[model samples]
Structures are given as C-alpha cells and as structure tokens.
Target: MEKSNANPSIECTVTECEYHCQDQQYCSLDSIRVGTHEQNPTQKSCTDCESFELKKSY
Candidate 1:
C-alpha cells in the first residue's frame, strides 16, 4: 500500500477507511464529510462519517 500524509488536524482511528493514513491514527484527506442518519439526531452515535470508503484488499 502507498503511504499517505496524515492531516495533523484530523485524528482518526478507523483503519478500515480507505482515506485513513496507513502509518498513523489520522486521515489523509484535506477534508471529510460528516452527516447524521437520524432526522433529529441528538447524540454522537447518531452521526456518521459520510466520507468513509471501504479499503480495498489486495
């Protein structure tokens, strides 16, 4: 896999995300899209990372 520069401002722990920096607990993208699944979301669990993409296995 190719190494990616981690965005210092964006810390992440989802290793399954394609945009996650392979060498660090951070995201490589310049920005990310966050959304909510519920119409009246009121908690952290209701939120979702819309930018998430499954990492392709080779």
Candidate 2:
C-alpha cells in the first residue's frame, strides 16, 4: 500500500511494518503503542513497538 502522508513526528525505519511509509523513514499512524519485553527495561533495545503489524504479502 502507498501512503500519502507520513507522520513526520514518528520516524520509523521498519519497512516490514504495515504502517510504515514506503518511501520515507516515517510511520503513517499518528500514535503508536510502545512496550517492553524485559521486566526491568534498561536500554532502548528492551523497548518494542507494540503497534507493529507485519505487512501482508499478496
């Protein structure tokens, strides 16, 4: 899918995400859910984008 507007405030590089802007490093959604897998998150890697949805292949 082609996205017309990229949420400039949310910069994303995960192309596999359905909400990611195809042509730019940005997310199409205005807001995203953020979560952590570790009980005590200490770094950025511990956090995850809970809103990420894998793009469907046709």
Candidate 3:
C-alpha cells in the first residue's frame, strides 16, 4: 500500500514507535504485527506489536 499521511484512519498514541510517522499521529508502515507473548492470551496486555521498532528521536 502507498504510504500517505492523508489517510486519517489510524491514530497512533505511541510516539516511541519507529513505524509512527514524524507527526506521531499516524503509522508509516502499511501493516503492523500483532501477536501474543504467551501461548494463550486472555488479556489485552498480553498482546504486543512485534513490528514495533524503537524510535531514535524523542
């Protein structure tokens, strides 16, 4: 998919994520990796965005 900031569908609150755009309100990546850390997830906290990359800037 073409990366565009015009799409105002996804709003990322995690500014520390590298996939997040410079604005810190949108995701640059076309898709995100979502998986659970445990064998069987029963809570929302158990899930993680595996595609999340730490941002070098603050």
RMSD of candidates 1 onward, in order: 2.1, 1.9, 3.2
Off by over 4 Å in 1: 1-3
Candidate 2 segments whose C-alpha is farther than 4 A from its true place:
none
lDDT of 2 by residue, 1-58 (tens): 4465799999999999888887999999978899999999999999999999898751
Ten-residue segment with the worst summed lDDT in candidate 3?
A: 1-10
Clashes of each: 0, 0, 0
* TM-score (C-alpha) between model 1 and the true structure: 0.88
Q: Put down candidate 1 lDDT per residue, 1-58, tens digits, no spaces.
A: 3438788988999999988887899998888899999999999999999998899862
**C-alpha TM-scores of all predictions:** 0.88, 0.89, 0.70
In model 3, the Cα lDDT at residue 36 comes to 91
Q: What is each predicted model's overall lDDT from 0 to 1?
A: 0.86, 0.89, 0.70
Residue 17, candidate 2: alpha-carbon lDDT: 87
Candidate 1 achieves a global lDDT of 0.86
Q: Please name the candidate that would achieve the greatest lDDT relative to the true structure.
A: 2
> What lDDT would candidate 3 get against the real structure?
0.70
Give the range where candidate 2 is weakest over 10 consecutive residues by summed lDDT.
Answer: 1-10
